[model samples]
Target: MKAFFLDAAVTLTLTAAITTMAACVGPGAEAGTVTKGKIYASEAAMDAPLYLYENNHAEEGGKTFSRSRYSDPQGKALVEEEVIYEAGKLKQHTYVQHQTEERGTIDVNDGKVYYVFINAKGTKTGSDKWNDDMLLPDMLGQRIADNWELLNAGENLKVRFLALEVQDNFGFKIFKEGESTFQGKPVVDLAMKATGFFVALAAPSFKFAVEKEAPHRLLKMDGRL
Candidate 1:
């Protein structure tokens, strides 16, 4: 999240009810420019493989609305969607399944979940009240309760990885830190991690890269857990 037209973090929280927040990350990201096709790149976003290896970039700053073009296999102009990001939060769902289309190496809609950020445990961040949206069955939930690797026995923090329902190169690494609350009652922060394989699944052959490690990709988050 960069602070260009809007402070991504501040805007996100203020627009909490917007329901459509851009979730995005890059090595060194740029934005649309005033002059047609003008661009820039920061040193930091450039260093990360997520932005570097992708082999495409968008300029930061300048015109709020500008369009560039990247192509697809059938020579179609790819319409990239806006990445939804959050602040002081675990995961920012950039792509949602319900609304998405590619354009010029940019995603148009703000509903695509290519990646998820997790704490140490297996529970999802922020969202604690488990329900059908968790994509878990009675038996699977039992397995999670049984085999989860506990990082903090006191907080009941544990971790687990599972294959998805469709198995379409998509997965989430969870950081379950006991029970918390969202609207009310209790909930958990299941920060799911995704891989480049997911990118390709969403945008066939949509070249991308990801790095996994002790604390970078997989993390023991700074939470009560």
Candidate 2:
């Protein structure tokens, strides 16, 4: 079966990255300045639309943590998450289910990346050594932004990340449906379809209500299949 877990690739991996090297904010230095907020999936039919929360450093602008939750068709609660760049070159990931957790930790050694995964019982389940194909979420946004030419030209853009070699990366132009209100603010209705390698078979279409501004932060997403 093509598992529902594949949806997580769209949810978490959208923000994937090899955690960047940066100095940890000191306690006396704007430590609690993390801005936190949640964005919801905008589809009306979805009673359990995807909900995501991100904690971003107010001073640094990069995400510190991101969590997303949605219910599968079988009514099982699922969450996929990432904790980034805590102190050293370490990042944490968790995939949650009704009773089990698939957890992973990523670390760098001699400029090579590897990850270790464990089950809910705290037993080491698997590990990948010198893995080159790990998906980094941080690059996904920039990948779309860097291809503004194609986006503007109304092209079906093929997105590629060197580190995510095995994933299917594709995006399509979403016509402006109209104007709408989201979170008490005005937004533009734009639609796009995206499929990562893991969820390529699903080929989900996403609707976005974006701030009609220069750096449009997504106001809402309709990520229903």
Candidate 3:
């Protein structure tokens, strides 16, 4: 698939990967299946069985989506996240974490779709514009390949990636090494992360499953990784 890269002058780093060809939906990826990795909305193992899933969206071109942050695990939303889709896949996502005085309205200006900054003044940035998808060629497949290699290697060199529906094409190819129990249920060694944010978490190797029956815990989002 063809992709655009930010000039070296923008972030001063380089990484590459194989991307989806025109947002082709992978086999069996119609529902949400949150898993662990460099970045994603993963199902919590020990917490209140909180779960999140990335599901399939629109088809072809600029399609918009709405995400709601709620007080109930599956109820009335307290906050909303406006997301954009391209070729049936997620292109950009933005949500105001808090409505406190420390926050304000986040506006997407200058034709930019997705945005993020690794710096305080929002100096360092990334995008999800035309040919500017975060996961590059070979990066959005069964095995984590190319480009994102640095993300698993570099220290102090932080990265944020975006991933789509976690049904079959999106859930983890996780395997169980032995029988285990977490919260009185079967648990397995698992990793979780978001696909579209600038945060990486190694979630203390877990064995948790989604219990449409539980709630999600909020992680404190204002500290260094």
| The best candidate in terms of lDDT | 2
lDDT of each: 0.23, 0.38, 0.26
| Tens digits of lDDT, candidate 2, 1-225 | 011111211221121111120111211123343322222233222344233333333223443443334444454554444434443233444444434555455444554554555655564433333333233443333333444445545555453222222212233334456678765767666555443654444545555555555344443444433
Query: In model 2, which runs have C-alpha deviations exceeding 4 angstroms?
Result: 1-81, 85-99, 107-113, 120-146, 160-198
Q: What lDDT score is found at residue 31 in candidate 1?
A: 43
Whose lDDT is higher: candidate 1's or candidate 3's? Answer: 3
Ranking by lDDT: 2, 3, 1
Instruction: Identify the runs in model 3 with alpha carbons over 4 angstroms from their true place.
Output: 1-66, 72-78, 101-189, 192-203, 210-225
Q: By summed lDDT, which 10 consecutive residues of candidate 2 come out lowest?
A: 15-24
lDDT (Cα, tens digit) per residue for candidate 1, span 21-83:
122222222342211110112223433211100112333332122222223323343322232
In candidate 1 the C-alpha lDDT for residue 63 amounts to 18
User: Candidate 2: global Cα-lDDT?
Assistant: 0.38
lDDT at residue 52 of model 1 (Cα atoms): 8
Off by over 4 Å in 1: 1-76, 90-213, 216-225
Candidates 2 and 3 compared by lDDT, better number = 2
Whole-structure CA lDDT of model 3: 0.26
